[model samples]
Target: MIDSHAHLDLADFDHDRAELFNAMALKGINSALIPAISEQRWENQLAIAQQYHCYFALGIHPWYVPEDINASLVSLENMLAKHAANDRLVAVGECGLDKLKPDFDRQQQLLSGQLKIAINMEYPVILHGVKCHQELLSLLNRFPNPKGGVIHGFYGAPELASRYIELGYKLGIGGLLLNPKAKKLRKTITELDIKHFIIETDSPSMTPYNATEKRNTPLILPNVASEIANLQKKTTVFILERLNKNFSQLFELS
Candidate 1:
């Protein structure tokens, strides 16, 4: 299986990152897409990807937008250009709007800039939307990335899922599925095909409701897949096979 979105590059895994990767591999998670949240984390993300045989994306996440958003966008463009030939450098985000965050206007600007970069770079996007579905749809309508992307950590209704799928975006199914209280989300998953979704851990964050550890890890991926399998009334192997195909197709992996 593959983790479509995971912040494994963050400091949260500094103590046992290597050990965790080994554990994840043994758990059948062959790779993860480590997305950048800020300019400062890009090099470390690339380094981790290189060492671990993982893929990564470089873009400024909405939460980490700097005071000079324009300068950051330029740097992101240069970085993408510099590593254009690097097959491991896939996609252009972890970037999108969040309604709960402050400076809604600035967040829109940052997301727009990143979308433009993604479009120009011909890369699929790794989007994050929290209670900003309508806003995200509107912005996506304006930008219209043909390469498509995944809506990371998706927790919405069937209508919303269809809307994103219509736009060529896959719904990210992650730790949210483990929450017993996520009735609507589970129902939505039951109604949708596995092709429209990809698995993610979002490690060190979005801890599953049933998790024993405080911090999440990619090792939880099989459990996450099992949750989806139960929701879709399928076996774990069936879910993983299709989800792995979705992951490979999105990032153009062999």
Candidate 2:
């Protein structure tokens, strides 16, 4: 399985980072996509991908946008250009709008800049939208026929999700599905085609309900797949197979 949106570089895994990778491998997690939240982590993210033989995405995250947004964007663009042909660099984000955070306008500007880069390079993106789906959809529509991407940790309604699907984006299903009380999201998932979805852990965050006291990891991906399968009334093997194919197609992975 591919853990499509895991922040494995976060300090949470500092002590057992290598062990975590082994655990993920043992649990059948074939690859993971570690996204950069800031320019500071871009090199570290790439190093982690190289060391672990996984994948990574480079973009300024909404929450971590710098004071000089333009300069930061310049840095991001330079980095993207430097790694334009790097096979491990699969996408252009972990970038998007977060209404709950400060400087909404700045966030939009940063995301727009990165989106332009992604679109120009024909690279898929890994987005993080919270309470700003409509605004995000608008920004996405600005580009004509942009390459597809994934909306990580999607908890929006079916209509919003369908809008993204229509725009050539896939929804990332994370630990949110583990909560039995997330009936609305579960129902939305049921209504959507499984092809429009991908499984992610968003690890070191979004800990599954079953792992109440522990930091989340790619090791929990099978349980995530099982829950998704249960929600879709499909078998676990079928869900895994479909998710693998979807991940491969979305990231152009082998």
Candidate 3:
């Protein structure tokens, strides 16, 4: 199983990160998408991937767009160019627009810049579009068939959901759907073509509904998989296998 998205480099997991990785391995989730959030995180993320044999994504997140954004983005281009052929560098993001962020203008600029980067590099993106779905959809539509990317933590209407899939983008179904109260997302996810969906934990952030611990670990993947299974009226095994295939295709995992 691919975690599809996670931030294992964040300090929150300093204590049990290894144990959590071991637990995930034992759970048959042998790989994960470890997204880089900031310049401070690049070395740690690479070190963690070197240590754990996982994948890494490097891009400036929208929320953290700096005053000298060009410098940071240039750093990202250099990072990708240097490591593009490295098997461990799986995707081009943890990057995209975030309307909820404090600086919408900077976020939009950063998002467009990264989208261009992803297209140029031909790497799939772990996108982070939130309330700006329409804006993103419009951008994607500019290409009759864009290379496509994952809309991480997707929580949108069914019509908009279809619009993303129609645009060649895959929807990421994660912690949000675990809530029975989130009927709208649940229904939208259920109706989505399994081929166009990727299961993600977004661990260390969006924990399952009854999460008792403050730190969300990848070991809890089974619970999230179970929730998705229940929604699809299928077994956990079936869900994981299908999700695994979807993730492998998205990230070109072996």
Candidate 4:
């Protein structure tokens, strides 16, 4: 299985990241995509990906839009160009809009620039949206990523999901699936085709329901798959295989 999105680069896992990766590998979670949160995090994210033999993405997240947006975009472009030949840099985000955050205008600007770069670099994007799906959809329409992308941590309605899938994007399903209280999200997942979804843990955040600890990890992925199986009335293996296939197709993995 592949964790389509995870922040294993964060310091939350520093104490035992190596051991954690081993645990994930032992559990058959062979790969994960660690996306950058900001310019400051890009180097560390890249280092972790190299050491752990995983893939990563580079872009300024809406929450971490730099003060000098133009300079950051230039740096992002240069870094993307430098890593263009490397397969480890699989996408161009963990970037998108979040209405909950301030400076909506800057977020849009940063996202616009990243979308342009993703198109030029010919890379799929790993997107994040919080209460800004309509705005995100509008921006995507304006600056579409021809390589396609995933809307990470999707918790929208079935109709909203169809909108993204129709645009050739996949939805990233994570801890939200394990939440028994998320009735609407559960229904949405069930209504959509499994091929349109990819599993994620969003580790160190989006902790799964009834989790022993507050901090989430990739180890919870099987539970997620199991939950999806229950919702779809399919076997866990089938869910895993299908999600892995979806991940491979979206990220251009083999």
Candidate 5:
């Protein structure tokens, strides 16, 4: 299976990154999508992908937007052009709006710039939207016909999710499913078609409920899939197979 989103290059895994990749491979997670959050992390992300036989997306994250947004955009564009022929370069983000963060306007501007890059390159994006779904939708409406992308760590009502799916975007199902209090998100998952969702761990961030501590790893991806199957009243195998197809379609993986 493919982990649709994961920051495997984060310093949190510096000590055990290699060992964890081996564990993930044994757990049937053959590949992953490592997203770059800053210009500094792009090389490390690419190195991890090259070593692990995975894929990556490069873009300036909203949280890491530099003071000179124009320079940051220029750097991002240059990186995209430089890696355009890299087989491991799969998408264009980990970039989107987050209302909770500072500089709301700047965040939108950075996100718009990256979205334009993704559109121009004909590459799908991996978005991160937190409490900015409506704003994101409005921005996405301008694109009209995008190459398709996924909204990572999605947690919201069915109607809101439908809006994204209608725009050729899939909702990423992550550790949020492990939360018993996520009634709204759980119900939304049950009502949506499996094709509209993809499995993700968001490792080193959204730890599953079964995890002993807050730290997350791709090893818990199966647990996420099992919970999804239970919520959908389907077998784990069925869920895995369907998600594999969804991953391939979303990222254009062979």
Candidate 6:
């Protein structure tokens, strides 16, 4: 299984990154998509993907936008161009709106800019919307359909989630579903075709059943896969096979 989203460049995995990769290999997590947070981390993100077996996603995250928008955008475009043809750089993001934090206007502009890039290049996007689905949906409404992507760290309602579905995007189910009290989260997943579902750890953030692994790395993918299997009422093996098939289908990876 591919961990659809993770941050191996983050300091959380610095001490044990190699061990974590070994664990991911043992668990059969064949690949991961490490996304750049800002121009600051894009180089490190590329280096990690080169050293590891994973791929990288490039874009300036909403939170990183500063006062000089034009200059920052110029820099971001330069970064995107540098690795435009790199086979390991799959899709564009860890990018999207986050009204849950501050500077939402900035988020909107950055998200729109990245969406334009995704639309132009036909690259599937990796979103990070939080507490702003309506605004996000509205912002995305302006863009044309066939939105190639998944909304990472997804915890929105089924109705709003359907909007993304209608736009040809997948809803990601991750560590949050592990909580017993996640009745609403499970309800949303149960209501969808499991094929449209993408399982992710958002590692270094959303640790699944093994919360004991405080750093949240790809080693937890088997547990995340198991949790998803239990939620979908299928055996782990069946779920893994189906998950890999669906992932390959969505990302156009074999």
Stretches > 4 Å off in candidate 1: none
TM-score of each: 0.97, 0.96, 0.93, 0.98, 0.97, 0.93
Which segments of candidate 2 are over 4 A away from where they belong?
A: none
RMSD of 6: 1.8
Writing each residue's lDDT as its tens digit, candidate 3 over 202-252 gives: 879987778888667776777778877877788888888888888777777
Give the poorly placed runs of model 4, Cα more than 4 Å off: none
Candidates 1 and 3 compared by TM-score, better number: 1
In candidate 4, the residue pairs with backbone N, CA or C atoms under 3 Å apart (3 or more residues apart, or in different chains) clash, namely none
lDDT tens digits, residue span 115-201, model 4: 999998899999999998889999999987778899999888899999998888999999988888888789988888899999998
Best by lDDT: 4
lDDT of 2: 0.88
Whole-model lDDT for model 4 versus the true structure?
Answer: 0.90
Q: How far is candidate 2 from the true structure (C-alpha RMSD, Å)?
A: 1.2
**Tens-digit lDDT track of model 5 for 93-159:** 9999999899999999998888898998889988999988889999888865467899999989899
C-alpha lDDT score of every prediction, in listed order: 0.90, 0.88, 0.79, 0.90, 0.88, 0.79
Residue range 94-199, candidate 6, lDDT tens digits: 7888776788888888888888877786678888888888887887788753647888888766787788988788877787887777777777776776787887
Residue pairs with colliding backbones in model 2 are none
> How well is each residue in 38-110 modelled by candidate 2, as lDDT tens digits?
9998888888888888789999899997999899988988998899788889898899999999999999999
Candidate order by decreasing lDDT: 4, 1, 5, 2, 3, 6
State each candidate's clash count. 0, 0, 0, 0, 0, 0
